[model samples]
Target: MPALKSVTDATFVDEVLLAAGPVLVDFWAPWCRPCRAVSPVVEQFAARNRGKITVVKLNADENRETTGTYGVKTIPTLMLFRSCREVSSIVGAPSRKALEAKLREML
Candidate 1:
């Protein structure tokens, strides 16, 4: 299974923006219930799309800079970045099928 790499304000630029392929960034906080709820779905999506896209998590609480830059006002926000720009975003904890459908559209 592919594991989600944790990205911080310091590494966000290189890890997400400069990545060679599409990246799915999960902006979450440890204390967020919704974030916890969506964790498994995100993990499953990452594992299934391992070679097609890169998946990373950014703690909104700890990575304030990147969170602010992206205007992430909510936890469990999923952003799809392509060619250094945000191509799509999902702001809530969506079901596996819903999330996959949305991401498939974006990809």
Candidate 2:
């Protein structure tokens, strides 16, 4: 699997907003069971679509600024960004097939 990078509030702009292509930001927290459950699926999706998209993980507990700015009320939020704006989002732990289908449709 491709290594998923970690993003912080300080790096959010350079990493996601100004990225050359689409970015998949996985907003999660370490203590959140749902977040842990979906992590592998997210990583696998990233690996399969490596060159087509950039995937990053943002810890909701650690990055309050970006989390608040994005209004991420729930853990395991998957946000897709293109041209510095969010185009799609998934709010919870979805099955691999479900996640893939949703992302495929968006991409």
Candidate 3:
């Protein structure tokens, strides 16, 4: 199973931005119910798109710089990045199909 990695400010560049492939960054926090609810979906999406995309999660509370830079005002915000540039964003809990479609397009 492909597991969604938890990234911090320390690893943001090496793990997500500078990675070899496209990435889906989930900006979330422990207190967010929607974030918790979509965790499984993101995990499964990561598993299915293992080679084509990378899935990661960042805690908004801990990574203020990244959060503010990305303009993430809500919990459970998902940002799609390629070549170190953000291409798209999805807020809230999206269906697996919806998430996959976005990732697939990016890949």
On TM-score, the candidate that comes out on top is 2
Provide the TM-score for each candidate, comma-separated. 0.92, 0.95, 0.87
The lDDT per prediction is 0.89, 0.92, 0.84
1 versus 3: better TM-score goes to: 1
lDDT of 2 by residue, 1-107 (tens): 65589999999999999999999999999899999888988888888888999999999999999999999999899999999999999999878889778878767
Off by over 4 Å in 1: none
Regions more than 4 Å wrong, model 3: 1-3, 95-97
Candidate 2: regions farther than 4 A off: none
Model 1: what TM-score?
Answer: 0.92
Error of 3 at 61 (Å): 0.8
Could you give candidate 1's per-residue lDDT for residues 13-94 as a string of tens digits?
A: 9999999999999999989999998888888878877899998999999999999999999889999999999988999887
TM-score, candidate number 3? 0.87
Clashing pairs in 3: none
lDDT: which candidate is best? 2
